[model samples]
Target: MTNLLDMRNLVAGYGYGPDIIHDFNLQIKKSEVKCIIGPNGAGKSTVLKAITGVLKPRSGAVEFEGKDIAGKEAYQIMRQGICFLPQERAIFPNMTVAENLKMGTYSLQDKRLAEERIHHAIETFPVLGERLHQLSGTLSGGQQQQLVYARAFAIQPKLMLIDEPSLGLAPALVEQTFQHIANIASSGIAVILVEQNAFRGLEAADYGVVMDLGKLVFEKPANEVLQDQRIRELYLGKAAKQ
Candidate 1:
């Protein structure tokens, strides 16, 4: 595949074998921030799951870095330099912020190497460094989300799959969260960001793909797609500018 990620002719769904995502095709370049946006129940999250191996595609290929990764296990994908950060709150409530980040690198065989990555992660997220000793459960909602992201980064995956990054945060916090995601991409990691903040998601993405009833309705450069009236109406449920 010419892309870092290529999902072609993919059809996947939850158990019933009825594909919620049918005939989907998407390709993301290396080190790019690609965001998927659509209305609720539009199968946006499912696409992330499929890419992360949380849900297997019934047919078609999910190629990553030239290998077909379809049907592989989640941890296997992680080992191959891809990590998925779910929209759900995933922090260890009782663990200190630093401890949670440490847990992420537990599987690495090299302790010193792991520490090196941890140092990098903390430096990238200084707020996390400040909260090193604080219990994760006690942090603010945005802080908790940041912790989850920090933990994921500790694994040092080449690809990061993010789902609904701004789902429940206040508007101000949401902006901060998206800003962090942008930085993650800028740091040379390929990010597949699935978000409900369509306008902001589109703005943050290097490329944008619109989903409608589980199908990819359109894919275009972020700026160009945002200006497409039909794409906006189909997924945003609003009339677009002329």
Candidate 2:
């Protein structure tokens, strides 16, 4: 089967700066979750930015559904069924939960379909439903994260580009965040996750990708990655090698 998303030979960086991603290549099947883990400055997040058009690739192709999407505007790429959740919390603090969800469907032209999706999101995350009228800023951090995920869910994107989903959460909330990612993947949406917590990220993913110095070090099935001695020693620490 054709891959859901294919990025080949991607080179990108901010304007006038040296490239941070070098000949990066990645591919994911529909509904598969690929987690990228590496030390700081490894360009993991740069790959997402290139694919999502936040930083246009200086070279190579980003293909989704067999069409090249390289250099398209972020909104254009999003409208074509890709949702990007940055490392920071994306919820609008001033908006009510219901209003936040409504914004998720902003790209959809069909009002009825948007409403249906909103209903589906609420059903999938009943907590969001219960908090619909509450101001998002007043919600707890975990609840606010839930609102972020719910909004992403409402969009029903074919692919989700998630950058550091567990970046700034209490340890207890971290597991809950990964569960949300798993839930999204289970619903048949491909996910490209860049996470700081390597072990947890790989556990939630079908595949584990390791990168360093702006290049891919290796890619492997998540289980194999978790078991590989070199990977364990390098990324997961000496304890993981036991």
Candidate 3:
């Protein structure tokens, strides 16, 4: 159970503003799904930003695969076997599904390997395969998110930082989306998930982390954390206990 990604004493913020994520520490093992849960402005997404190089850490280390990647740029981080899917649907509206998948492999130098990955993505997500020539913008919200997931997987990253995959989706779509993510984790790529839907996130996660006001407040197995009365009451509201 070696750590794939480790953030130690991380302090990061936007621009000249004060630090939003303070002394953040996290370690994710290979093939594990670690879900981060908290209310809005809890710096949950900020942690992902620091790891993915959207914002640089003012101090501390971001170690991926035993190498310190603290100050690397976003592309540099991606080259190191990590890819990020932001909260937003990042697909190109004008591009076809097949073309969007091709865009995801821009970093890979091997044409054959990239093509292999594309085929694998299509196989894993058959919807994308069936609609390869369809305009990505014309797809439903859930389909677009699925496309984003498929595109991220096209690079065959060892670790994926996914921000709010369920955002703006209906309940059934949210369930489908999490199942897709769970399937990805089951295939051995470590995932650090920032989720607004606490219940489902915990349900799908192997490990659960709770953050508040720029720091971690709780950490445990996802099931244990979900059943904790204190956590249930504090973050998930009173109905969680019933």
> Which of the numbered candidates is closest to the native, going by highest lDDT?
2
Off by over 4 Å in 2: 238-242
Candidate 2 Cα RMSD after full superposition onto the native fold (Å): 1.3
Model 1 TM-score relative to the real fold: 0.92
Candidate 1 residue spans exceeding 4 A from truth: 237-242
| Ordered list by lDDT, greatest first | 2, 3, 1
Candidate 1, residue 107: how far the Cα is off, in Å? 2.7
**Model 3 TM-score (2 dp):** 0.96
Q: Model 3, 19-40: lDDT tens per residue?
A: 9989999999999999999889
Off by over 4 Å in 3: none
TM per prediction = 0.92, 0.96, 0.96
C-alpha local distance difference test of each model = 0.86, 0.92, 0.91
RMSD of each: 2.1, 1.3, 1.3
Q: How many angstroms is residue 185 displaced in model 1 relative to the true structure, after the best TM-score fit?
A: 0.9
